[model samples]
Target: MSTAGIGLGLTGFGVFFSFLGIILFFDKGLLAIGNILFISGVIMTIGIKSSLQFFMKPSNFKGTISFGIGFFFVIIGWPVIGMAAEAYGSLILFSGFWPTLSVFVQKTPVIGWVFQQPFIRSFLGYRGKRAPV
Candidate 1:
């Protein structure tokens, strides 16, 4: 109902699309769609935050850095390596939003727990409590 709600929705789609893109990296059409959705989620969720307070945290710093490097490789590096980087970067980025993202994923009747596993959270670089509202 609010902008934040929309942002969260975009983030969900972003995750889904990124996964799809990774799956169909060889298919230009689906891969393009995936790339678009992934970027849209990041922009909607964080682009509007002009305040330094929104991005100055250590986790956010790590996430953005990972995302930036991954994006660069995905755009112009070797195919196989690029895809891997994209996945890793996305994991970190998604982890950065774990608190909020989990709220949506947890609503699912099945498989939510899988997504919330400690190893996945740690791998994605999720640390400390959920991000500030």
Candidate 2:
């Protein structure tokens, strides 16, 4: 599960970076390079999953919901994905955005400060909230 989380996170970051790069850069040559890199990153990520296992896997409610969301995102984000691929190869690995964004929000200033607030931190802590044995 942890490995899957890491893989998904890397994929999300790759895709996000790729999108930012292509949109920010106008050089055709550079864009071509970014696209190639993005494709490579995607291929690497996908390689982590076994094809037979993927098809043969069973789905629970969580899996079904996740798959639905993913399918919807892919359908809606197709154009954005192209631009992302043209910008940064890392964008190819974008499934980890939620956790990455969470960590980023905690570390980066402005938005970061919001997530890092004392009250929020205390509320999120589980150390003292467990039920007595």
* Alpha-carbon runs more than 4 Å astray in model 1: 1-9, 25-33, 50-56, 96-107, 110-133
lDDT tens readout by residue for model 1, 79-103: 4565566667666655646667665
Summarize candidate 2's per-residue lDDT along 1-133 as a digit string, tens digits.
5544555565566556545645765333433444444344444555545533442355333443343343333435443444433223223233335455556567777876766666665564523342122
Model 2 local distance difference test score:
0.46
Output the TM-score of candidate 1. 0.52
What lDDT score goes with residue 122 in model 1? Answer: 61
* Ten-residue region with minimum lDDT total, candidate 2: 86-95
lDDT for model 1: 0.59
TM-score of each: 0.52, 0.32
The lDDT values for all models are 0.59, 0.46
Count of backbone clashes, every candidate in sequence: 0, 18
